[model samples]
Target: MQKEAIYHRPKNNFAYAYDERTLHLRLKTKKDDTLSVTLIYGDPYDWKDNVWQYHKQKMLLTGSDDLFDYWTTSVEPPYRRMRYGFYLEDESESLVYTEKGFFTEQPLDTNDYFSFPFLNEIDVFKAPDWVKDTVWYQIFPERFANGDSSIDPKGVLPWGEYPPARDNFFGGDFQGVIDHLDHLTELGINGIYFTPIFKAKSNHKYDTIDYLEIDPQFGDKETFKQLIKACHERGIKVMLDAVFNHSGYYFEPFQDLLKNGEDSKYKDWFHVRSFPIETKPLPSYDTFAFEASMPKLNTENPEVKEYLLQVGKYWVEEFDIDGWRLDVANEIDHQFWRDFRRTVKQIKPELYILGEIWHDSMPWLQGDQFDAVMNYPMTSALLDHFAHETISVETMADRLTSLLHSYPDNVNEVAFNLLGSHDTPRMLTLANDRKDLVKLMYMLQFSFPGTPCIYYGDEIGMKGGADPGCRECMIWDKTEQDTELFDFLEELISLRKSHSAFGNSGSFHFVSAKDGVIQYKKETTTETLLFLINSSEVIQSVEDLSLSNETTSLFGNKIKPNTALTLEPFGYEIISL
Candidate 1:
């Protein structure tokens, strides 16, 4: 055995309390190096005479990536606390692995094994249970609809008249959202993630001037309350964006600091490098990516922490909002988020807290801070393989497998998975306007683990590039929209909701990935679902896929038992057995 390649650590992704009674454990070994792994575990105090009593259970080889094979199993420690170790073996030899070190045989003393001291109910990472069942729709309020054009900003353009720009507005508001709530409901979206509805100068609303007040352009707080009521009545949850990382130039504190130079009471609220703030050569103070209009907030300040915490609490306590999506969450200090989570969750214990982080976010997801982060890594992988064709199917599968193993299973369930958001190019545009490819991408996203999300207008094939380009006005005219793509996505959402194996309730595994074809499975205790996608231009076939007499196709054509499955270019199949 390759002892150096074997790895495990307690109290993180590798080992965690899956629930109050169950503990999930994982072990990693060099790719194909270990033929089998057995978990030896026992309650630390369950000993008699001079030896420790324990039970051994075999761990399943869940999946393997380029460099490692991941083994996983669950144990229900009777006493809710245990010491554990792994016995790994290859053809040549076997070894016992534990906290102390590798040994020729299983350690006699429990102290030599890894310890999960106890499984406290509070420490179990419990995100809102509702999140796993939700399919989110991300709406940029400024572009969704203009129900009441009377609230239009000064230079608001005619809706859909011109391509979106940083400075242009099209009079989208909460009333517009209220007007279009039916569209979301009809599309089966149960959660709406609105990007920054608070008062701000920019059309995107990331640069917040007022954290507590709704932007007049999006209507007043009363109208927003009505909108919330409308959404809740229709069984939809609302999640608003909170940009606590920075404030706009016109933000009262920032403006005051700019005016008073050195003697502003809010001086500690921001990171001002020098006395005279200058935005000419470079920002004299810290800002969001050198943009002079946005000054990064010093969240470490006690005053700033209290203010932001109240902002978090006010929405849930007052409006009964269901969730908060933290903007640029990775930039803030960890303690502030811990306090933020405690504050909002105390008001509504189940209120979802999502973070806008584009990379690995395990630190913030440890039951205390964020329930989930924007799954941009999965987004990038999907875009790379299905849309851009920059990576092969095998490479994409490897990347996804690694990502799934990066966090605890519970965290992955509520992960905010998205393909294109306000931050990236539309899925159709990224797929070079091939709606079939976009359909393939959607199939994988909806079938994969995590709560999937759809960017506004993506279901109808709205095409745009990044940033300002991605923020186009939603198409309201039925004649101009791609109704077929809409129907396809609607079906996907329906399947995700109606079928347990098709959603987060099932366990996911990559079955095959080769020659531009990818195959995977979502299996529950009673049912198994097989998904196949052909990313290549030419037709592809998979031989010898066994099917039962009772098998049925959820998508693609029905097939016979033990038949070879064939898919057209950019086609897919979802088989239920």
Candidate 2:
């Protein structure tokens, strides 16, 4: 470590983990000087018999603007006491290491066997470790409600113009939700996932014009405080959509660089190229992965990193929010998250950070970064199984097997299992108002490994499809509400909440996959519950069912399966013992 070189995490002492097969290794210097970094994995304590020397591996290293990024083989060779280091390839060529009665004239190998010891503790946020069995709900605020109208915006932004249709304010602020906390409380959800309340342009505030400011459309700072207080009072924690991957076209940081061009004080704030666009359809820097509006920021830039990190810390310090739902998380630089995680935990150790990773998210969940992901996988499963009827029992079995194995055992605990969201249609329409299948999915949602997040309208049997359609207003009129569906959902939640073990203590095991009928059991040390579902159109005669004698069905219906438990079409049950 040099006195002049600057690094994002300059204190030097670091701790890292490789959660899946993907390995992203990075080292920061005090300054942006010409330097080089190498990664080696094996027994850092012993290079015994040359067997400890790991070689013949594929590696990648690239430098963009200033920061250097690279990856290496992620093979864990059952070795203990593994050490790695960074060596600056400057003219001076200094080697960095923990001092313990040792000296190096030149850059020393990170895994160079040493006798003396150097010790310091570093805590890496392990994901899926504690969240695999919990369920989460995702909510879009504007559509959710205008909890408080006193704070609604009276005017629009100076540069805002969207065909007069895209008004930023929609009366759905945090305080509005405070007016109706019981809407979610009745569902027995442990947390609420709100999209970016941070200042933005569009209705679905993905483009973070200002990370620090809460969108006026959603009320001001104080309103958020009340919302936080209200939710916390009711045992429901809150996590907001963290849109750090990109910024709105009008974001001050980006706008400044655009106006000042190369002479801008923050010239290196983005991935500048030789050709602003090389043509039209793609502007200079006004795109994400080269689109048109969602411009990607250079997270590798020091200034940019500092700004975003501060914003994340602001929420924790200002509102005591429980977690963050990072948007477009996969597209951003991995090192940035590593830094973000460290900075956030400094404010609150229990801050849960879930990424918007639609893929397997195995790598992200491997005890290193995110606590969970918006379970698009679970959503797709529910859609395919209940709607399209394409997912068969065996196919489901195979998918679940691979899903559990994809990440470590903890993933299912944290995955937010939503039947539908504002991004997609409500389950009512998706299920075509079948009531039966919807109830079945609700049972599965709560019964499954992850936390079940009920979209505000979805619980009351709201219906719609796709973006604008899915993002409909909440039906405040519970008078005409689908009481049957609502009651069934309550049963599922009550069953999980009443039994301490089922909350997260139980392990899921499939009992039988007969035709379209799927049966599974959730059991912890002190409790046992059985789930019986028939996804088929025909009634099922499930014989020798794998359930216990002591049964209390959810929806307050207690029944037994003596003469081959008969499932009326899409019948599903959450029976407890």
Candidate 3:
């Protein structure tokens, strides 16, 4: 046994309350090193004489990545508190692992075992239930449509007439979104995540000049209210972007600081390095990435915190917005977010709070700060394998397995998963314009755990490069849209919503990743779904799927129980058993 590779802890993902009564525990060992693992646990005080009374339950090998195998099991302690340890075995020997260290035999002292003090129902990570079932559509308001051209910004270009630039605008507004509600409904999107619609100088609206008012270009507060009402009437939830990390150059406080340096009462609102603020060369203050125009706010300041908290509360209390997608959330202080979560959730207990974090966000997702973050790690891995062809299928499977084990099951269930977004290249562009590859990527995204999101024009096959290019105007002309690709995605969204085993309710596990083919299964209480995708250019065949007699094909080719299942180049199959 590789003792160095064995590991466990009493908090976070390794051990957590899955619900009010159940505590989920996990143990990790070197890949293929341990043949079996069993959980030895009991209430800490449940002891008689000198021996500690306990029960042992076997842990299932839930997943294996490149370096580790994860074993998981659930326990319900009668007293709601317990101490636990793992008994691990390989062919050669067996060992008892506990908090103190490795032991030749199980320890009778409760102190030697890892302790879960109590399963507090309040500490359980609970996101809004609606988020798990939602299929999000991310709309960059400035590029979506221009329903009321009368409110068009000065020098606004004709829609889709030219390639997008950072400073250019096409006068996309709330009315534009309200006018085209049918597009999203037909696409089967139940949640709309709009990029910043607050008053700002740039088209992207990340640099906020005013948090309480809607940008005039997007219409006033009344128009936004109407948009929210129309969306709710259609059963679509709305999530607005909040840019509290920084303020635009024209933001009043920032403007005052630029003018009155030391005399400004708002000097503490920002992080100014020197008495005289300068924007040339580099600003004398902290800014978002070194951009002088976007000054980072000192969220630790009491006034700043109060103002932002009010901003969070005002939206939910007045407009009835369903959620808030926080931008650059990781850059802010943890306490601010904790207060933010409490303030907004108090008004609307089910309001979804999503953070725009691009990496591992376990610190902020402990049922305190954020319900979920933009799942960029998963996005990068998927893009690298399917779109860029930089990683092999086996490597892709390993990366994905590691990602799933990084968080609790509930966190993964509501994670904001996306392919292309306003920040990256379009999926088609990343896949070198191969529609089949894009479809394959979508297939995996929708079938995997968590809610799936689509960028504005990705379903219709709009192609662009990064940043400004990715923010192209939505293609409204039906003749120019890729209806075939649209239909494929529409079917996927429907499958995700209609089938229990095909969505977040199911348990996911990898079956195989060999011969350039990646296969996995999503199992529920009553049904199991098998998904097979050929990532290679050549056709692949699997001879022994070991399907049951009652198995049937939900997609792709149908085959007899013992027949070799052959898939075409870049092909896929969805089997139901």
Candidate 4:
């Protein structure tokens, strides 16, 4: 066979794309390798509208051209922050940098951009404040309940085995989820954040074995359709977790590499060095360098970038999922995030994309990618005050004050406020099933600045911890059994629905905090609501809580703050005007 020059690391497909700093330019030239590769950067900030023409320079290879090493000509200085591509000298063919190999740049007219500073505000990643008070519920499918027992594993999974593996499958699924929609709606949850439903080997589905299909165990595509319709009917929105960080060990692309080694067509899809077995921990192999079961992807690969982008758009076009909750967001490269966010906005301008960040997310909240994230820090603060009581009234005030002042004003609107999720101990369980204390926690959750979210069963009181424990199913049996806690959650939820000024785009100010009594006010142009919670063990009273004129008394606000309105230990009050 005639010697062939190709970009396909799979060694079959000749297609090539440039990405990150390394340009994969291959050509079976009648000319020699002495030919120089020219790169130019004219558009300072423009990737779409402005212009760029290649300026020539000999492609140098004194050292390895790894993913992060970029190249350009002397005529055009490379812009550290920009949108540009590469061109091969012999072919005049240009390739754009992507998660996979490059694709030909389309006509400039094809690219479109809307007015700058999108959404209700300029912060691209920040969601509106209403997100926090609205209350979100995260559900892990398998282990929740086997709605269709027939689909359950033949007792072959870890949930049935001793020393269950975190990655084992137990068959909790969509139909089981369908059966619980009523429970979710009645509990007053406004958002449903589901773990990955896409086809994958592990029960958690973080490793996407197949991005295109739903896990058969989770039910077919239409079943989710019904679930979506039902959720929307009840005023609930659904968001699914997206694990773009990596895939399972047995994923098809990796399998291809195993079968063909360097000759595989998908060889470029992952990051592998020149040597086969020796490069096992290739740049893409050790994401956390913690495990070998999951292999990270070379998101800088142009084809890989396009492939994942297609997967994201496919779900939105096919199932109409309200948004995406990115799993292990920080693990991915910054270059990948920039492209990913660009593609997402091009597809749907308003789609909600929340990152799964634990510590703090203000950095990503800047104009570009995610809308919000799991409020792990906030959850910790709430639990500290109510669970161990290690937090004092003053300590609690300081924390709340920091949250209000630390983040940009707009971030409060879009944050995913959580007390508990499948990742953490259930809130009710954290409070040790103390209904009074639980009520106190939620009072702050709802009236505070950000969007609020309830764990699946926390509304009616669910309990568990990391992995199998945090993944417990909602208990319907309790519906008939415990009316006190159930009634309390129901009332709190109803209160959230009735108040708009307290929702998104509202403003929050700490009104007072003294003697284990904390109070705040949420206000808009037309409406205002006041909140008070006594996390103390003793009945506590406040001195003077200022109120707006002509305020009507409701649920917890019927009593006077100092004497008549003394809140007992773990008691909470929601006062609106």
Candidate 5:
């Protein structure tokens, strides 16, 4: 028994309220060290005569990584209050673990057990229920499609003629998005996350000059209303970007400050360091990443707070936007976001608020702020295992397990999982243009829990490096696109939407991983899906799979029940039982 490897805590992911009535508990032990674990729990006050009343339920081995195995179970107390502890057994020893410490035998006193005094409904983390069912499609508007050449920005380059650069713009507009509604509908995405459509100076639109107006390069107010209406009619929810973290250098207020030193009426709107602001060798005032073109806002100011709060409310109340993907969310103050959530949800209670946090985001995800954040950690793990091949299957599994266990289950369900976006290299490019490796990457992404996003052009096998390269013009011509890859992705999306087990409605666990072959299972109440992937150059076979004869193949043709299966290099099979 590896006593030192056993771990559990009373808060956070280790112990959390799954809902108003149910509490989730987790325990970790050295990998494969524990044969079984039983959760012995009951209300601490439910004592009869001289004995403390309790019940014991066996815990399931939910997931494992290189160094640890995680066991979990859900329990409901009649009073929504309970004290609990674990009874673990290994091959050679058995022990009882409690909040205080390990015990050679089960303790008679309920005082020594871990406690959940009360399960308050208000404390449970509840994101929008609709978010888990969404399949997001990220669109960089300027390069998607030019529906209105009449509204083209001056000096716009011909679509798809030149490689994308920092300053170049193609005439992509709201009408363009409306024109391509069939593409998104056929591809089966329920959510459209536009990068930034608000009036801004740069092609990317992160440097916002006006928070309320739709960029003319895109369309007018009425045009945007029509676009949203069209999307809603097609069952697609619309999410716009909010760049409140900074303002463009040419913003009216910022320009006034630049022209009139400290005496300007808008002096307190930003973090101005000196009387005369300079954008030379170093910005005279604090900026976003030291870029003089983007000045950080003074979120703490009373007037600034009202202005931004109104901006946050205007879209949801007037334009009927379904969500807001906050830009640089972590850099802003927590109070601002909490208020932002209140303001937006007031207009639409189910509105999704996703943040652009690239690191641990528990602080902003306590159910009072953003509902979810862009899942960058999962992207890095997939890239390392599938694209870069820098880690073994076991190591990758371990990393993934750790990430999953780092958050409450509710948060995990709605996390914005993506392989590529405007901020990173395309998955195909990251895999050195290896189609097989890219398929494997998407397989894991769709199978894992969370809302998955498809970067524009990636569905058609687009390839490019980071930034300007990844932000290439979308390919619309049938002859120029990789239809085969598109077909493969379309099938995967269909499977995900059709099966409850393929998305957040199920629980995930690795069934087997050896050599270059990996197998995992996603199980729900009514269905089970088993995926076998071969990531190596050689063929692989599974001879001991215990699937029953009733199992049906959901993906590949050769897979059958209770039989050996063979996978060619980079091949995959999804079977339903």
Candidate 6:
């Protein structure tokens, strides 16, 4: 036994409430170190005749990453409280692991164990229930389509006539999105995450000019309401981008600050280092990424807080949008987000809140702030393994396992998972234009947990490098789009919707990942799904698939049960049991 490798904590990913009644506990040990683990747990107060009442349950080996194996189990305490410790066994020895230290014998008293004090229902992390079933499609409105050229922005170029630039617009609007409702429906995605459709100076719309008004290039308020109505009619939810972290240079408040300096009534609205603001190497005031045009708002200010909070409430209250994808959420204060959550959820209890945070975001996901972050860590793992081939299949599996165990199941379920957003290079481009690699990437994405998001043109095999390039206009001509890839993506989305095991609530575990091939399984209470993918050029054989009697081929070529199967180069399979 690798005693030094044993790890656990009283809370967080190691232990947490799956809900009010159930507690999920996990322990980590060095890879292949512990032969078995038994969880000895009971309410700390459940004592009779000077002996603590307790129960012991065997923990299952849930997953392994490159460095560790994760053991997990779910238990229900009659009293909604728990004190626990672990018994580890290996060929060489047996030992007790407790809160204080490792021991040769189990501790007699419960005080030596870790305590979960109590499971508070109010503290449970509850994301929107609908998010678990949603497949999101991200649209950069300015580059998606040109439905009404009459509302085109000044100097707008012909659609798809040239490569995208930082400040260029091709007249994409809500009307265009309304026109393409059928496309989204046929593609089988149930949610639309539109980036910054509010009034802004730039084409991407992240630099907000008005939080309450829709950008003229996208359409007016009424047209947006119509678009939302159209989407809801088609069984699709709408999520708008909220750029509350900063304001554009031309925003009325910011402009006034630039003009009035110290005398501006809105002087407290933003952070200012000096009387005369400068915007050269660095601004005299704080900005988003040192960009002078984008000034960070002082969300702590009372007036600014009220204004932004109302902005958070306006869209859902007026247009009935289903969610808000907060821009640069990590840069803002926690209290403001908590108030924002209260304001929005009061309007619609189930409305989703996604944050554009690129790193660890546990602080914002405790049910009091944003429901989920953008999940860029998982995206990086996928890209590193599938697109760049910089990491081995085993390494990828380990990375994913670590990520999945980093948060509670509820958080993982609603996490906004995406691979080529407007911020990154296209999946196809990253895969070096290899459709096979792209298919493999999407296969893993759809099969893995979380709500998957497709960049606007990716399903049709649109390819480009990073930003400006990746933000190309959506291809509308059927003859020009890659129908084969689109159809395949549609099939994948359909599979996700129809199968319980593919849903975010299901369990995901790696079956195998070695010699240029990977296999994983997703298990729900009602079904089990196995995905076998070979990313190498040579045929790969996986033996002893361990199919049950109810196993059947869900997709890919049919194979015999409990027998070895050969996968062609870049081939994959989805088996249901």
Task: Score each candidate by Cα lDDT.
Answer: 0.92, 0.65, 0.92, 0.62, 0.90, 0.89
Candidate 5 residue-wise lDDT at 69: 88
Candidate 1: regions farther than 4 A off: none
TM-score versus the correct structure, for each prediction: 0.99, 0.74, 0.99, 0.71, 0.96, 0.98
Over the stretch 471-577, how does candidate 4's per-residue lDDT look in tens digits? Answer: 65455576434667667767766766677765664567666667778777777788776677776778776545554343445573454333445677766666665
Stretch of 10 with least lDDT, candidate 1: 549-558
Model 5 TM-score relative to the real fold: 0.96
Backbone clash pairs for candidate 6 read 65-398
- The predicted structure with the larger lDDT, 1 or 4, is 1
**Residue 198 alpha-carbon offset, candidate 1, angstroms:** 1.1
Model 2 accuracy (lDDT, Cα): 0.65
Count of clashes, each model = 0, 29, 0, 38, 0, 1
Residue range 1-577, candidate 2, lDDT tens digits:
4534423221111222333222233333433454555443444545556544543233322212222222222334343244443333457755433222223542245434221122212323344333443345567777666655566566532221222133444556677677877867776666788977888878788887888888887877877898898888887778888888788877886677767777777667766674433325556663566654567788998998999899999999989988888888998877888889889988888888888888867567544577778778767777787877787866665465445434433455667777787667778788877888888777767767776688877778878777677776666776857877777777667767677555666767666665998877787878777678888889887776544564557546656656466777878765775
Deviation of model 6 at 297, angstroms = 0.7
Question: How do these models rank on lDDT, best leading?
Answer: 3, 1, 5, 6, 2, 4
Candidate 2 residues lying further than 4 Å off, grouped into runs, are: 1-137, 153-169, 275-280, 289-291, 546-562, 575-577
The best candidate in terms of lDDT: 3
